[model samples]
Target: MKQWLHLSAVAVFLTLLSVFPVLAQEEDEIDLSQIMKAAEKKSLSGGGFLEFQPSLIGLNRDSFFYQLNFGDQGPKRVGQYDFRVRLEGSYEKRTVGLYFTGDGLLRKGFQGWDSRARLFEGYLSLRLNPRFTLDAGKKTTKWGKGYAWNPVAFVDRPKDPEDLLEALEGFYVVSADITRSFQGPLKTLAFTPVLLPVLENLNSSFGKPGHLNFAGKVYFLLWNTDIDFLFLTGESRTTRFGFDFSRNLKSNLEIHAEWAWLTDLERIETSQDGRLSTTVSDEMSALVGLRYLTASETNFIAEYYHNGAGFGQRESEAIFEQAKSPSAVPGSRTGNSADAVFPPLLGIPNPMRDYLYFRTSQKEPFDILYFTPEFTSIFNLDDGSCQLIPGLTYSPQTNLLMRLRGIFLVGSEHTEFGEKQSNYRVEFRVRYFF
Candidate 1:
C-alpha cells in the first residue's frame, strides 16, 4: 500500500512537471500566484453517477436493493445496463491511470464505504515498446471468457446477494503481457503471450500457488461472419491449457466453446508415507447460444454451457424460504452459515456467482487456473433466469427508455433447492438518459 502511495505521489509530481513546461515558458511569465490555479483548472477533473434500484424476489424471499454510482467517467453500458470510466496518460515508457466502472445498484457498506469498493478495480499499466505491457493494480483475472470472467461488480449490477459476495477482491496484479496486434479494415488479428510476475497482495489462498502460462488468440472476419479464438496454458508446477472459439451463426444466433486440459497439475500432493507427487487432470467444456428476433416486438435468447467435469455455474440470487413455519427455514444451518445474517441496512450483497467462475494466477498476470462451481441460477433452464433471457426495449415516447425481461432456468429435482425444481425472474427498467 505504501509503495502505491509513493508511486502515486511520484506520478502526480511528474504529471505537473510534464503538463506544465516551466522551462518552455518565459522566466518572467512564471507567476507563483497563478501556478496553483493553472494546474487546478487544466489538470483536475471529477464526475459521479446516481441510480435507484428495487427488486421483488420471485421465490419471494428477502429481496430489496438500493444502489448509486459516483465516479469520474465510468463503464460502458450494455445497451442500457452498465458503464465504465477509465483515465489514461503516458510519459515515455511510464504511464499513470485510474479507472472504475459499476453497475446501476450502488449499495453502501460498513463505515459508509461502497460495497463494490472492496474489490472494485484500479491499476497502473506500463508499456515497454511493442514487446511488453506491465501492469500493477486491482486487476481482474483473465480466466475463460465466460460470463464469470469479471470479478469487480462495482459497475456490473448482479441480482443476488450470494453472487455479489463471491465477486473477486481487488488484488495487486503485476503482469507482463507481450503482444503483437493488427488492426485493419478487411480483417484483424493479434496474438499476445503473457507472463505474470510476483504480486505482493494477491487475492489468493494462504498457500496460493504461483503460475506459468502460455496463451495466444486469433480473430478473422470472412464473409459477413465474425470469428474469435483464444487458447491458454497454465500451471503451478505442471500445466493446463484452455481454448475458446466464437462465431456468429446465421445472423441472429451465435456459438462459443471453452475447453481446459490439465497436465499433471498439482498444488500439493502428499501421501501417508510422506512421498509427494503432483498431478493435474484434463477437462473439456462447450457453450452454445442462440438468439432469435421474432417480429421485432418479441426477441429471445437461449444459452447452454456444459463442462466435462461438471464445473460450470451462472450468477443469480439464492433465496431462503421466508419459512411459513419459522423452523421450516433451517436458518443458520444453511451453507456458509455466516451468510444467514441480513445485509447491511443500506448496502446489498449480490449473491451471484461466475457465469463460468474460474480465476487463476492471482496477484500476477501468469496466475492461471481452472473454473469452479458457483451454484447460481444458470444451472437451471426452465426454472432459473439464466439459461433463457427474453426481453424487449421500447421508447414509449422517444424521450423515455423502457425495457422488460424474463429469465428462466430449470433447477434439478435433486440440486439447488433439492425438492424445489423451479425459479424465475422478471425485470422491468426505465431510464431517462439526458
Candidate 2:
C-alpha cells in the first residue's frame, strides 16, 4: 500500500510540471500581444535632448570688427556658457500627422545674460496616398545637394559651413508633394510646390513684408543620379532659378553641385568715406563638391563655391577701410549710424566671392569605439584667408555624447577672416538624450 501511494504522488508532481510551462507560455503570449497592440495604438510619441556648452573665446582686440563693435576697451579673453533644451513630439493617426520641435536657450556671454525660445518646426501633414501628400505650417524645405554650400536652396535658410548638418529655423509655408514611379532609367519623379507668406510679425525675416511667395521643385532620379530644378518668385524677394545634382560614381565616392540664378538681386557696399551704396543686378551663384570614404573609416570632403552675389575684393576692402574710421565706433555717431553699414559685413557668413572647403574625419582610431576626430579648413580664395577647425567627439555610453573643438583663423591684415571678432575659440559640449 505504501509503494502504491509513493508512485501516485510522483505521477501527480510530474503532471503539474508539464502543465505549468504551457500555462505560463500562454500568459506570456497574451501579455506580449497586449503590449504590441498598445504600441500600435499609441497616437503620441516624444523625445528630446539637453545640452550644455561652454567656450573660451580669444578676442581680437586690434581686429577691424572688434574695434568697431566693442571699441578699444574690451577683455582679451572671455568665457561663455550656454544651456539648451529641445522638445520634439509627433502625433499620428491614420492619414493625418502632426509634429513639432521647440528649442530653448539660455546664455551668459559678452553681452550678458540672454534667453530665448523658438519653434524650429511645427507642421500638419496629410497623406492621402503614398504618392500624394500635403503639409502646412513652419517647416524646412531642405533643398539642394551640396554638403557645405547650397546656393540653390531657394526656399530654405542658408547653411553654416562650420555646422553644415545642424538644424535650421524654418519658414511658415503651405506645400504639397506629388510623386510617381517609373520602370526605366528615370526610376522616380517628384514635384513639390510651396506657398510662403511674409506678414507683419509672421515670417517677417524671410523677406519684405506683405507679400506671398511661390516656389516649386521638380526632382528626378535618372540613371541612379538625383537631379532637381527649383524656382521661387514673389514681391518679397527677387525671382530665382536653381538646379542641383548628385551622383555616385562608386560605392565610396559621391559628387554634387548646385547653381542659382537671381534676377535684380541687391548688393550693399560701403565707400571709404562711410557712404553706403547699393547695386541691383543679375547674379549667378554656384557650388561643386565631392565626398569620398576610404576603407579605414576615413571620410574626405572637398568643395569649391562661387558667390556671385557676394562682395568683391574692392568692395570688401572699402568696407574694412571704413570700419577703421571714427564714425564706426560703437557710440561715436548718435541714433545707430553704424547699424546700417556693419550689419551686412558682419551678419553674413563668408561674404566674399570665392571659397574652398576641405574636411576629413577618422572614426574609431586605434581600435577605439564610439570616437571620431575631424579636421576642417575653409579657405577664402579671393582674400587668402582661412579658418581651421579641429574637433573630437566621443560617446562613452548610450544616450550621452561629448565634443570638443577649436577654431583658429589665419589671415593677414585687411582680410575677411582677419577682421573677425575672435581670432581663436575653444568650446566643449555635452548632450544627454532621452
Tell me the whole-model lDDT of each prediction, alpha carbons only. 0.38, 0.88
lDDT of 2 at 60: 89
Q: Tell me how far the alpha carbon of residue 96 in candidate 1 is from the true structure, in angstroms, after superposition.
A: 5.4
Q: Lowest-lDDT window of 10 residues in candidate 1? A: 62-71
Error of 2 at 123 (Å): 0.9
The number of the candidate with the highest TM-score is 2
Which run of 10 residues does model 2 get worst, by summed lDDT? 330-339
What is the TM-score of each predicted model, taking all chains together?
A: 0.47, 0.89
Per-residue lDDT of 1-434 in model 2, one digit per residue for the tens? 99999999999878876877666466554566877875775789998999999999998887766765677787899999999999999999999999999999999998899999999999999999989999999999999998788898888888887778778889999999999999989999999999999999889988999999999999999999999999999988999998999999999999999999999988876567656688799999999999999999799999999998898777777777665665555524333333466675656899889999999999999988999999999999988999999999999899999999999988877788887878999999999998
Candidate 2 clashes between residue pairs 3 or more apart in a chain or in different chains: none
